[model samples]
Target: MLETSARLLRLLSLLQTRPEWSGPELAERLDVSVRTVRRDVDKLRGLDYPVEVDLGPTGGYRLGAGAALPPLLLDDEEAVAVAVTLQTAAGSGGVGVAGLGEAAVRALVKLERILPSRLRRRVAAVPVSTVMPLRAMPTVDPTALVAVGAACRDRRVLDLDYTAHDGTVTRRRVEPHHLVSWGRRWYLLAHDLGRDDWRTLRLDRLRPRVGPDGLATGPRFVAREVPGGDPAAYVASKVADVRAAFRCRVRVAAPPDVVRERLWTDQARVDDLGDGTSRLHLAADHVDGAVIMLVGLGLEFVVESPDELGEALRALATRCRKAANGTSGGRVGAPAELG
Candidate 1:
């Protein structure tokens, strides 16, 4: 009886490892007859495991979704990975999902209670830390994320009320394409039906329009190719546009491709001037911040905007000179001006 029970567990683990398995393949793996494989599959079915059978020369058995979630089988690596992910998510205040932290803690507790001592030691050895930001991050409504995700998957249209950064609320009908989790914020890449354009919208500022029957999704539409053939890149460009408060155009002494490789997408937009040089457009919240980024590029650059950026650069040069000379005699500058 104990042998049979252990074989049943091995069979379950094997089935969970792959999407489908033939009877002959299972028999070979278990060193049992095909008849015994069929009998064990029947026993799994009797236990409400939803083991589905396909009848034919090329058919195979596969596990299907049951009415309720069954216990999952995980290898050592997978178990450790899941525990670490859960721990990080719990510590991150839910990764933009409202109320997910407490739920993650609960789930982690349950998982830890069932874990073996060896696995517990492995999980404990992992060094995971979450640093809370000075400002609280905007969180998305879990219901909105679910609705938007479903619409994206099913190629359905969604009617939503979106709040713009300027505190303007607008009703938008869009075909949801993808949900992007960039940093702590969630963004939706969708084609706006009303405006006849593609848009990257913040999930936290979005509320799905619901009816008496729950979320009122529009009829499924043919999936359209995302702009630039990449959803993430498109969303990143849009985010850069929104975050650009202090914009500076600089002429760099480097090729466009080289500048692009050196900087992140959100840092600047580089345009080739057909010469050996490249034009870089940089944006940041303050001029000093932009100066710092420009200096870090390690290439010669000429700032061509706002005039304040030039002043900040000169001030930075002065500070660098003062530090190099080790002289405090020159009317100590006003709080470094980098703020």
Candidate 2:
């Protein structure tokens, strides 16, 4: 009886390793007869596992979706990976999804409870900590995320109502290709049918069109190659264009390569001037923010455009001089008394 049970578990594990398995292949792996494989498959079916049979010349079996989720079998490596990922999600205040942290905690508890002592030790050895930002990030609807993810996987078209930053709402029909998770936000990289262009849309701003049946996903689409053949790079460029309010130029006393290494590729563009200096084009929401970034670079720079940026730099320098001379709180050039 124990041997049969062990074989059944092994069979289930083998089936999960891939989408489909031939009867002869399974028999060879188990060192059992084809008849025994069929009998075991029947037993698994009796236990409510949806084992589907393919009755073609190349006969095979596959696991199908059932009403309820079956217990999953995981190898040692997969078990550790899942435990670590769950720990991260649990620590991260939910990754921009409402109630995700609590859900991750619940799932982690269940997984850890069933984990072997060796695996538990492995999971516990890794520590995870998350520091939340002061600003509130937009949260995505879990249902909408799931619907869009399913559409991406199934190559289906999605009709969505999207809210722009200016509070304008417009309906869009898109063929979603991928979901890109950046920081605490989720973005969809899709081809816009109406505009005849590719668009990176925020998941929070999207409302999937629903019919009486459920999420109204349309016909499957032939997937297109992403712009530049890289989805992440394309999305990053699009996000930078949308978020940057001030495109300020500066001449920095550094080589182009050095400046590029110090700044994020999406945040700044550096061009070599061939005289030990480089031109830096960066985007920021405000001139003060640009001033802070340039000062933090630890290199000498001259603001080239946006006279307001130069004014901000002058203002910052004056404030710093006042603070340094202990005259910021009192009268000009007055030394502060030691407490």
Candidate models: Cα lDDT each: 0.83, 0.84
lDDT of 2 by residue, 257-321 (tens): 78766663245666789999999888876776677678878889988898888887877777788
Top lDDT model: 2
Residues 1-339 of candidate 1 have per-residue lDDT tens digits of 998888889899998887679999999999999999999999999899989897977679888667887788888899999899889989988987999888889989998999999999999999789978434678888888878887786577899999998899999999999998765689999999999999999999999996543454587799999878999778866776776678889999999878876663254677789888998888877787687778878899887777888888887788788789997455665464553
lDDT for position 75 in model 2: 92
lDDT of model 2 at position 27: 97
Clashes of each: 0, 0
- Model 1: residues >4 Å from true position, as ranges? 1-78, 95-103, 116-126, 129-136, 211-216, 251-280, 292-304, 323-336
